[model samples]
Target: MPLKIYNSLTRQKEKFIPINPPYVGMYVCGPTVSGESHLGHARPYITFDVVLRYLTYLGYKVRYVRNITDAGHFEEEGREAEDKISKKALLEKVEPMELVHKYTNLFHWAMKQFNTLDPNIEPTATGHIVEQINMIEKIIEAGFAYVVNGSVYFDVKKYAATHNYGELSGRVLDDLLETTRALEGQDEKRNKADFALWKSAPQQHIMRWKSPWGEGFPGWHIECSAMATKYLGARFDIHGGGMDLLFPHHESEIAQSFICNHVQPAKYWMHNNMITINGKKMGKSYNNVIKLTEMFSGIHPLLTQAFSPMTIRFFILQTHYRSTLDFSSEALVAAEKGLKRLWEGYENLKKIKEENFDLPDDNDLDKKINSLLDELDEFMNDDFNTAKVLANLFEIVPVINSIKDGIIEKNVLSSKTLHRMKDALTVYLENILGLQSLSQNNETFDGVMQLLVDIRKEAKSKKDFFTSDKIRNQLAELGIEMKDEKDGNISWNAV
Candidate 1:
């Protein structure tokens, strides 16, 4: 099946075709560096991270660009007020860049913990000020931007006259203009509909820069349009962001790029549905967010218990990206158990060797496994219906477990079918999905565990109750909680 994507621009699933053959460009809006990212932030990135990995796995050279909004999105007038990052730093008495650095580092660490593939180009808004300035200049030279009092504003009314301005987000220009009432504090802008291209900095603004518009920073929307065009060119393949950004943020981007470069920014306009908590938007403003760290440690008041990064990953993957995922402690606990059971089956598939199995001359195991594998690709191709793909995997899990436990006839499978089944499981589990076991593979760690187990075994053999219980208690505290079998061997894992 050909890969299809749900384009927010078209409001339909369209076949995905890269602008350039053999090379694909993807731009995903990344974390804003003013604060630590919450669970809501993880949805879009993790969704597209799989897209990037799957594209690469299918032999496309993909350039993935995810930006860092470190120094943008702040108040522009009145008291020379601080930018978001700067304001937070002042209230906390930390250096401005220190906060950016800390959050940026934390975002990276979180991505690593989730096993997300690093983007090809991770640009920062502060680093691309020159590019932003250049784009602003182009828009001005093209007569689609105007400057008033040293601050530049995009000429949205003028741009809309020529371009299909509302084509991307389905916003009607006339209604928007009619609904936009002038706010009390805005004297510099010619129109409320015209957004900031370059915001003039007042004396109090800490993250000020020298721009064509005196000392100011690029607007929140302009930074992305500028940086994406510079890194990916006038147009690219896929542009993904949250569905909430489809309005002012993305609408402005389309207008700016069309006026400045005479082209649409991307071919596939992908937007993941919003994450919700108790039917309300899971957002920073909503005050119902579960921070990624809090979710992992189960420290937040909202979460019932701790959840591993992979459990969270599986939970997200089980739902189609275009469908809203509801958050609850019950859902997370269910995901944890589901992932553990799935991984156990995958491990068993590895342990079952073809040599030990009885086989017919031409077993149909290959056909069965091939059908499942084909469905995996089929669902993914159908607008990235990840939920369907996961359901298919669950269908085959019982078979794999039965093969390992000798509950089913395995020798009836031919070598070719066996090999394909193994390959299919590994590819889907590791390569395309970008998921891996969240456990260390260190030999030293295993050896130490064995030694401790041996000590406990000796204690049990010697009838020393206190020693055996002490070892068990210490390991449990360390998350190497013990699981003993009827045969007397002790197993442990950090869950």
Candidate 2:
């Protein structure tokens, strides 16, 4: 089946036909390095990481470009117009670049923990100043922008007259013009809808650069347009980010790129929905922004216990990317339990060796297994419905466990079918879904646990209740729960 992507621009799922066959270019808006990344930041990166992985699995060479906003990102654009990095640096009493390096490194560490693949090119906003300036000049020459008080602003009203300003975001220009909310630099703009291409730096601004519009930095929106054009060409396959950026940030990107390049920036636009904390929007004002560090360490007041990076990744995948995921201790705990169950089933499936050459004795069961395996790809192809894919994998897990526990006969499935099942499970779980074993020391830990299980089993067989009870009690004290299966086998997991 051909892959379908839900394009936010058109608000429909369309067949993904790359502009260049066998090669695809994707750009995702990455984190601003002014502060530590929070749970709100996890969704887009992980969602796009799976996209990158699945495309590669489908034999597409994808150049995934995710940018780092090391500079020019403002805190609530139009309200304050203060640079995020510069503001944070002043508070921390450090150089702007120093603060950027610290947070950027932390962001990379969090991504590594989540097992997200790095983008092919991670361009920084500050690093592409020349490209941004040239693009701004192009917009000016095209009469889509104007200069005021040494600052350049996009002529949104003019652009709207010639082109659909709200095509991507569905925002009407008339309403924006009527907005009475007082904003910084409102007097300088020809219309309230206009946004900055370059902001003239105040004397106290430490992160200023010399530009044709005097000494100042690039605007938040222009940074993305410049970097994406330079790396992914004037047009690319996909441009992805959180739904929050739909209005001004991404909408402005569309306007700027169209005016400068004379074409829309990307063929398809994708956005992951926002994350909420216990039904409330996650924000600093709400006192609910859980940083990735706080989440892993369980240092935040909202988190009941430390959550592993894989557990958080699994939690995010449980819901559709387009749906809002709510974070709570209860939801996270449930996700943790679910992940453990799925991992255990995966381990059991891997241990089953298909030595019998016999054909299926249970044709119905065999067909059911194959059907589930086939739907894995179909679900993924249908706009990357990872939630449905995971559901199907859970259904197959019982069949795998039944086979391992001797409830289902080995030769019931043909050798070909068994091999296919194994391959499909591995490909979907590890490769396409991008899940990894929870711990690196899992092998050694399992070996030790298995040895203990065997020792207890021998003691129980010899009718020595004392030694068996002692082993069981000690393991229970260590928070390891062991279940004695009906088939006289032992299964264990950490409680």
Candidate 3:
């Protein structure tokens, strides 16, 4: 089946046809690096990572470009034009780039922990100031932008006269012009709907660059338009971000890019829904934003325990990308258990070898297994419905477990069917879903832990209470917990 994706632009699911077949270009808005990334930031990155993975899996040469906003992002839109990075730097008593470097490295570390593939081109806003300036100049040359006292502002009223300014956002131009009231200090703009292309830097502003208008930095929306155009050409295949950016940020991007390039920036626009906490949006004002560091370290008040990156990834995938996912300790713990169970079944399926060749002893069971396996692709093709795909995988898990336990003979499935099942499980779980084992990835650590488990088992068998207690206590002190199962099997997990 051909892949179908829900386009936010059209508000419908459409077949994904690349502008250039056999090649796809994708750009996702990266984080503003003034502060560490939070739980709200994880949804878009992981969602787009899967999109990139699946496109490549389908034999498309995909060039993924995700930009870093290290400068010129304001604290709030249309309120005060203070740069987010510069304001944070002043409060922390550090250089703007220093704070940018620190948070950028931290964001990279978190993405690595989530096992997300790095983008083909990770452009930074500060690095591409020249490109941004050039784009702004072209907009001014086209008579769509005007300079006011050393600052550049896009003429939204003028653009709306000839073009659909709020098409992507489903907003009416008249309503916006009527409702948007000018703030006390923003009287320089001709219309309240006009947005900043470039802001003039004050004397105390640290992050400033020379421009025709004056010494200033690019606006939040212009940085993305400039970087995406430079890296992905005049127009790209897919442009994605969180749904919250649909209004002023993405709307302004479309206006600016269209004025400069004479065409829309991206062919398809995708957005992932936000992650909410306690039925409220995760934000600084709500006091519910959980940073990635606090999430992994269990230092946040909302988290019950430290969650592994894979568990969080699995949690996000459990819901459709377009649906809102609420955050709670209980929900995450359920996801943890679900991922653990699925991983066990996956490992067991991998251990089954097709050494014995036989026809299906049970035709009905064989057909059922193949049908479940076949639906994996079908679900994913239907707008990348990962939640449905995962549900089908869970249905197959019992079959794998029954086979492993000898309740169902492995010979019931032909060699070809068994091999296909194994391959499908591995591909969907590890490659497409980007999940990893809950245990540590180090082989030496595994070997040492296995040795300790064996030693503890032998001590238990011989009734050597002292040695077993010492072993368990020492391992527990090191944050490892060994459990004796009812089946006389010992398993260990990191605390």
Candidate 4:
């Protein structure tokens, strides 16, 4: 089956056909870099990372671009065009670039922990001031933009008369005029729905840049349009971001690009659903955002314990990208346990050595293995259904365990099928899903643990119960769990 994607623009699933065959361009809206990234930020990065991985796996030369909104955008759309980064920096008593540097580094760290691929081009809005200005000038020359008091605003009413301004968002012009509230600069705009392309920054604003209009920062929406077009060209293969951006941010990008380039910016528009906490949307306003650091350290009031990065990744993959993934301690714990089971099975599969034997008595098990392996690609091709692929992989776990436990003979399946199973599991788990084993083997720690396990064994042989129990109790208190195996061997793991 061909790869299919649900384009938000068309509001339907369409077969993915890159405009330039064998070479694809993808642009996903990146972080604003004004504050620490929270759980809500993880979804889009991880979602598109998998999409990029899959495309690359299929032999496509993909140039992925994700931008950083460093030149702080406004607070509220129709209200005072105050820069978000500048205001936060003022309250914190630091330079605007200082804050941007702090958060941009932190955001990169979080992305590494999440195992997301780095974009081929990570253009910052602040770095491309000339491009943004040129694009805005072109729009103004096209008569789609008008300067009001040294500030530029897109003429929505004029653009709407010629083109459908709200087509991407499914919003009608009449309803927008009726619903938009009057703000400080509403009188300057011909219509209430007109959005800013650039805002004149006051002398007090620290992040101001000199533009044709005046000393002001680019508006929230213009930054994306300018950066995306500069890197990905006038028309690209895919444009992606969070669903929350569909209304004003992405819709405005479409309008701006159409005015200057006379073409749609992206062939397919993809959006991942938002992450919710408990039952509500996760946001700072709700006081429910769990920062990536807080989640890893288990420092948040809502988290019962620290969750490994892979566990969080697994939890996100369990839900379809288009579906809202609810965050909860219980859900995370379940994902932890499920990932542990799968990893354990993966290790067991590694122990299945190839045997030089004749064909199996029955081909039922062999055929089933091949069918399940083939289903992995089938599920992924169906709009990247990661949950179903995971389900099928889990089904193979028990079969591997069964073969290991002697319940099924090794010769029942040919060596070729066994090798194929291992190859498939490795590719899907490590390459496509981007999952790694959470447990690490530190040589120094392992040496100490082995010494302690040896001491315990010696104590048990000498019938010194006190010493053995003391070692066990103290290690338990330190979050090290020692397991006694059936063969009298000891193993320890950090809890």
**Highest-scoring model, TM-score:** 2
lDDT by residue for model 2 (1-495), tens: 899999999999999999997999999999988888999899999999999999999999999999999985557636666777888889999999999999999999999999999999999988999999999999999999999998999999999998999999999999989983656887998988898899998887888899998998897699999999999999999999999899898999999999988889999999999889878868666878999999999998888999889889999998999999998988999998898889889988888898766675358887898888889889989999999999999998898888887888876767777888889988888888889766455788999999999998999999988988888889899878777876798877774
User: What's model 2's overall lDDT?
Assistant: 0.89
Worst 10 residues of 1 by lDDT: 74-83
TM-score of 3: 0.94
lDDT of 1 by residue, 34-56 (tens): 88888888899889988987888
Error of 2 at 135 (Å): 0.8
| C-alpha lDDT (0 to 100) for residue 366 of candidate 3 | 70
Sorted by TM-score, highest first, which candidate order results? 2, 4, 3, 1
Better of 2 and 3 by TM-score: 2
Model 2 weakest 10-residue run by lDDT: 72-81
lDDT of 4 by residue, 1-495 (tens): 888888899999899999998999999999999999998899999999999999999888999999998988767656666788999999999999999999999999999998888999999999998899999999999999999998899988899999988878999999999998886578888889998888889878888889988898787698889988888899999999998899888999999999989998999999999899878889877888999999999998889999988898989998899999999998999999999889878877887887835666248988899999999888888888999999999999999988877778767878878888899999999899998787877899899999999999999889998999899999999988786654477767775
User: Model-by-model lDDT, in order?
Assistant: 0.83, 0.89, 0.88, 0.89
Which prediction has more favorable TM-score, 1 or 2? 2
Better structure of 1 and 4 per lDDT: 4
Predicted candidate 3 versus true structure: per-residue lDDT over 126-220, tens digit per residue: 89999999999999999999999888989999999999998999989889888986642368888888888888887877889999988988865
Q: Spell out the clash pairs found in candidate 3.
A: none
